[model samples]
Target: MRAYTALINPISGGGRAAERWEPIARLLREAGAAVTVCPTRSREHAVALASSAARRGEIVVAVGGDGLVRDAACGVVAGNGTLGIVPAGRGNDLARTLGLPDGDRELARLLLDATARAIDVLEVGGVVVPGNVYAGIDSMATAVINRNRWLPGALLYRLAPIRAVLTWRPATYTITADGRTRELRGQTVVVANSGSYGHGLRIVPTARLDDGMLDVLVVREGRLHRIASFLRAAKTGAHLDLPEVEVSTAREVALAADRPIPLCADGDEIGTLPATIRVLPASLRVLAPTAPRQSR
Candidate 1:
């Protein structure tokens, strides 16, 4: 039997993950498996636990949301071990990309069989991201949303961008993608592997995880009414048709601005620009369903 480490973030999903870990662990053990449930004391702790277990060639399963997934993925990728996800996080955006099943029965089946698929990763200034890397107003919005965790997750996520655009000033952004350089004043810039972020927003609707390239998107600064319309269209992915929106594909992207701007990957703030983001193609082995499902 393959040994497994379930890295549980107790505080994720409003503490629901911690409360639910016992049964999940029991289920794995009952199936004739070696299951070790590791409750993460902190993000750094989760990294250490996962890294140590993965280095020993154990399957490291992330049992929380995107943040925990990112940490566990870092460890698994470093050790070249397999990664599994439980889809218990708030966004579960990475799970959405992987077409991961939400039910416990399906999850157990997946962990046992351990179907492996190579997926692309993003390296933003040194932080490893399994999903998307973004910056500018949206990143600022993420930072703001983190501070107001008392509100419901969905409401806070949707409102943060609107609040941010109202007060956030547009900056002149210089972006070089695959050696082609361009400068524009935009509200946000995104390079995606799975293309989804900000609580189900299809920020890059056409991005593919194994494409060996990143989908680069830039939402240009515009009048308030125009920006509002752009956002509305973005909700349904219709914003791609707007003239102010530019989409392209690249293997690497470097972003810089006149002022220091924060950057985020999979919703966690990594650092500020000027920074280079590159695609590490087919780098991490992810345990996904045997049969493919529609990308959400």
Candidate 2:
């Protein structure tokens, strides 16, 4: 049957996503979708599969976590297809943003049933690089983060303070946004496309996908415990309310680093700095969740 299919990441969400294939397929079939299933074997494979699926004008639902969704996003954003999600991952960041249910089969039905909305995308560029992915942080941070990367999803936030303390102090960097420029010495600076990082952390909680603006947050020098305290406040939308956290809005932000810093995107590591970011408004069509999404 020629119908919309799901691209599943076998390693996502502890491989529980693969376990859900049968039920999700049945649900999609019941919803009048043909339900062709595609499994991603690697990063390049995901890109190839997603691009191929989008080329044929097929709606590809992400059946795994954010990494898989990001991979699928690379494909759909360039083509006529709209992307949907089933939140089965260590961090279902995008899924929560879309207000989809936790169950794979249920989310499939919900996405198939809802109205599609066009959302923005951030294309990050560095030196000769130009691509569609939000470089969340510098690459130096990615190295330090990867050294202790074996920790589970939620604990990574806890490790941030430790990384801040041990991985050397924050470097002074200059950032220019929309003809205005400033400098900051911080441990973490995030360029957010959509709100929510994962595991209930609101790095840029007030962000909106349709607003045509990118939100930037910088966590400046602070005690490790204080940094943890700040993350807690972010959970309830209070982190940016504090003096330690600085919030700014701009169409583009350029960062200058003495050395390449660590970087991350969607939920995985991309190459390091320097990074140039610009928001493309309403760049993608998405299946909005039926119910109201909880405030991110």
Candidate 3:
């Protein structure tokens, strides 16, 4: 992968990734690798750049947060090139979950020399949201997106799972899995494909990226204030042990609603939705090890 092309979002997270641009370029030149870096003008441009590189069989790197990575992943997954990350976005959730290094140089080495493996991602109508779990249901689903305003990192997240719990409650929604369909009221309906969502919060700790199945996390219905009460319960992942919380798995998921629900993919809130998501197992090639513990 000496001939490499990177699609970097300079404006992402206010140019955090761009901060390392020049030095990284210098190092790559010193390493005798041919490198080309391009800044994305918008969200859609990320995929356009990635798609162009994929068709050319070039090593494509995404230098932003999970949203940019997910966009690039969609572009390169069907092609023959490896999809890489630079990790400069706010959440960096996908990078943390994948056990990738901090920034440019480390990422360059990984792109140039590391072994690659195909990993699974949840594609909800062409948008790829990162993480292993899709928690909450219908109106409760909007609660997860609203929770993003909580502090921002790990310590804050220790308190986030419980945020707005009292103000929010489960809603009635139809769910289908393994050919079984039922109507249930729940606060969140999570689909887990990986363990944690950056900042070290594990919604589903045992998830695997290549398993070809999505782990489902369901929390039972509750009053608006009761949902807020779970703030403390979420700290230890005890929310899963609740009578309302149910775990299941499936190859595909479809969510339809009479009202708009906040939907986020890889940390970038796409829109409110009635949508479908499916597991594309071992779809995109990864440069790092198979699991978090196995990564060097």
Candidate 4:
């Protein structure tokens, strides 16, 4: 029987992560797996717990959202252990990218029987991000979401963007990708390892987890109406067609702004630019379906 260590965030998804993890844990135990549950006190605690468990050759499962998954992944990478997910948090973008099942039984089955696949992750200042790293308006929205955690996920995510857009102004950015540099005034810059974020929005539709490359997207400054249209189009990945939108692929990306601009990974703000982000090719081993589900 395999040994598993689950690090669960007590307050993720408005206090739902713990509630969701119960059934999953029961199922894993019933299947003869040795299950250990650790309720994480904070992000740093989660990383520490996962790292210690991983060093013992136990599969470290993050039973929360992308933020928790990212934290656990950092520990797994540090200890060189496999990572698993239960997707019990708001904005479970990484789980969506890997096509992890939603139901408790299916999720437990996946943890027990799925094949581990190697995927790329973004590294910024020693932090491993399993989803996209972004700046500008989207980062602002992330701040809003963080502050208003009491609101429902769908409603909060939708409203935060509108709040951010209202006060957002275009910033001059100097972006370097694989040594190629460009200076532009833009609303946002996203470097993606996973295509979806903001509750399934296809921000970088062409991005792939195993590609060993980062998909860089820049939304050039536009009028309010045009920006709104771009956001709507982004829902289906049609924003790539907009003239103001530019897309490229690179192994390393550097971002700097004329003024201080916050950068976010997964769903939490990391720090202000200038920041250097690199793709750690095939650095994370995750328990996912053999043939992964494609993001729409």
State the lDDT of candidate 4 residue by residue for 1-296, as single tens digits.
Answer: 77999998988888888889899899999999999999999878988998999899999999888899999999999999999999988889889878888899999998999889999999998899989999999999999999999988888888888889989999999999999998999999999999689988889999999978999998899865555566689888888988888889999999999999999999999999999999999999999987555542
Q: How far out, in Å, is residue 149 in model 4?
A: 0.9
Q: How many residue pairs of model 3 clash at the backbone?
A: 27
Q: Give lDDT tens digits, candidate 1, residues 111-196.
A: 88866999889887556789998888889988888788678888888788878877789889999988999999988899898888
How many residue pairs clash per model?
1, 9, 27, 0
Give the Å shift of residue 266 in candidate 1: 0.9
Candidate 2 Cα errors over 4 Å, as ranges: 126-152, 160-164, 290-296
Q: Across residues 1-296, which tens digit of lDDT does each residue of candidate 3 receive?
A: 36667778775655667775566667777888788898888777877788788888777878777668888887787565688777777667778877887666786677768888778888777766445434343233334534554345444444444454545545666677656777777666667777556355566655677777887777666544554455445546776677776777888877644455565555556655566778888778867745643320
Stronger candidate by lDDT (3 vs 4): 4
Candidate 3, TM-score vs. the true structure? 0.83
Residue 15 of model 2 has an lDDT of 71
lDDT (Cα) of model 3: 0.66
**Candidate 2: lDDT of 129?**
11
In model 2, the Cα lDDT at residue 147 comes to 57
Compute the lDDT of residue 145 as modeled in candidate 2: 43
lDDT of 2 by residue, 1-296 (tens): 23575889887766778776678777777767776788889877776777778788777777887778877777777666777777677667776776667676566666567677877777774211111233323333334444554577577645654565565666676778887888777667777777676465767877877678878777676654565566678788877777667777888888665666656676667666677778888776777654344443
For TM-score, candidate 3 versus 4, the one ahead is: 4
Number of the top lDDT candidate: 4
Prediction RMSDs, each to the true structure: 2.1, 3.6, 3.8, 1.7
What value does the lDDT take at residue 60 in candidate 1? 96
For model 2, the run of ten residues with the poorest summed lDDT: 126-135
